[model samples]
Target: NQRVLVTLNGHPLRRGLLPRADGSRYLLFGQLVCRRLGLRVGDTLRVTLAPDPNPDQVDLPEELAEGLEAWPEAAAGFARLTPGRQRGIAYRVDSAKRAETRLQRAMQELEQLARMG
Candidate 1:
């Protein structure tokens, strides 16, 4: 795996859900590093956070539609958020270990965001 260097010129930071080989999910926070970056589903990446940070090889995880669809309220709240914010929340939830924990956290996030008005 090669190190993915994130520089100041990276465009459009985005986060999304990816799938693991074991059928688990991971939240990927990545940038469009290069036109040659060549990203596809089920790709492994070596990413470095900064100049001094240790590089880690991470696998991309995919979103499970049933998991996301199970929480209709959270989905609605997610839709109401700015795209970046929604990505942030989705990334965080996808990072949870257990399905129940992810759902609970998503519900809490949605409730809190809804109360922000």
Candidate 2:
């Protein structure tokens, strides 16, 4: 799998290129991206692609960071997770708009990591 930084009509996105059976690769736009860009099926786009400088980097929420700090085993477990999984978890937590919700999601992830350990 190749990670890429994509620019669609000037909007920046970080995404992974999915491999096809024919060995070609494609990018799948999520609903959020579609809505943000007002994209529709069969619509043409001006696309630019570049290699992701830090494909494995995930922005850890402060709440998640603190929780991980307090739980060494959970931190270790989190480190063991695949980059995709780690990004998924961090996205869940980071997407929460409210502070309380972010903390809640972070704690929930920490609990799951604790169980994994």
Candidate 3:
């Protein structure tokens, strides 16, 4: 398995081709990636891709880990989610500047997910 490094409009970044339901692969230019590269819809982008070594990499926040550890059901639910969903939760948990706020957000997110199931 290989990851990918792409240069979009001269702005370099690493990403991977995502799987489509129809069995095709596509690169998603996410909001953060687009904004960083000053890209917009309908704008032409020059993209160059190269093979990458590390693919399954995500930084799960410590506070979120603590929250998950304390909530077994939420932990299992989190484990059941796809890698993308897990990263989305990790992103939200890390968004807060304050540690207390991060913990609160992390716990809140787990509780919300628990309720959803």
Candidate 4:
């Protein structure tokens, strides 16, 4: 396993390299940061520690905001989730390229959390 310092969402995140169940290099970041970054198993990622990669603020784009608004029920349900879960959803959505895909993922996560709840 290789050791490296990495930055995630503007914060310094130190993690260890470990083999995944499928025998790939996996990063073992803290649970909180992992949720905050919205990374999932087998997700490809890049990290640079020294130069912080500051993500923009959490204001959803106009179109995405409209989409989220269209699902008031989902948004309210999401609001009831723990801050960690909320951050997880936000992080995942922010990582998407297309607004539609982001909305879909956010909705999917909301459904999963709802089922768990």
Candidate 5:
């Protein structure tokens, strides 16, 4: 996987390479990225790419791990989610600095996932 710092019309942001559904590889300049930079489709862009030294696929928070351990149905549901969704959940849980907050968020999201399945 590669991590790149992309400059879109002089605005900079970092993003990683993603694997496409058809087994192709691509980089995404998402709507938020474009919006933040006041960019539109067909706008010129400057890109620079390099290998990420400490690239992490997804950093699963301990609280989320424990939540999965405690809820088998939630765990099964979570397992069936797309990698992007799984990674998003992990990132949200990990973003919380406090242990209790992380745990609460983990349980909330996981329970919702379970109910949806």
Candidate 6:
């Protein structure tokens, strides 16, 4: 698995290039990107890729950070998770359009993390 910056028809995306057993590589696009780009399976694309400069970087939303700060055990559990999992949680929280919703999602993630401890 290699983290990469991909451009599909001029749209920028951060993703990983996963390898198959046969040694071929492919990128997985999220539905949001697919819908935004009006893409369907098998659609041809103008693609370009490069190694991600900051592959391990995940943008931690303020609400999620605060939740982690208030729950030490949950924070520890979160730290134990894989980078992909942590990024997923942060993405979920950040995807919420409203502040209250983001806070709610952050709390929910904290609760789940707490249970994992």
Best by lDDT: 2
Reference-based TM-score of each model? 0.36, 0.67, 0.53, 0.37, 0.52, 0.63
lDDT of 4 by residue, 12-80 (tens): 654445677888876656554566679777777776743223332243434445645776666676667
Query: Tens-digit lDDT track for model 1 on 1-117?
Result: 223334323432332335789977554444433323656656665542333233332222234234336666545655566645654566576677677877677666766655553
Candidate 6 lDDT by residue in tens digits, 70-112: 8998999898998899889998997786889998999999999
Q: Mind sharing the TM-score for model 2?
A: 0.67
In the range 1-117, model 5's lDDT, one tens digit per residue, is: 466555555665556788888987778775645665677877777776656554544446788888788888888888888766787898688667577888889989988878865
Candidate 1 residues lying further than 4 Å off, grouped into runs, are 1-77
RMSD of each: 13.5, 3.4, 5.7, 10.0, 7.8, 3.7
True-structure lDDT of candidate 6: 0.87
lDDT of 4: 0.59
Model 4 spans with C-alpha error above 4 angstroms: 1-64, 98-100, 110-117
- Candidate 2: which stretches are off by over 4 Å? 36-45, 60-73, 94-103
lDDT of 6 at 87: 88
Q: Pick the candidate with the highest TM-score.
A: 2
| Candidate-wise lDDT, in order | 0.49, 0.88, 0.76, 0.59, 0.72, 0.87
Candidate 6: misplaced stretches above 4 Å?
A: 41-44, 60-77, 91-103, 113-117
Compare candidates 3 and 5 on lDDT and give the better one: 3
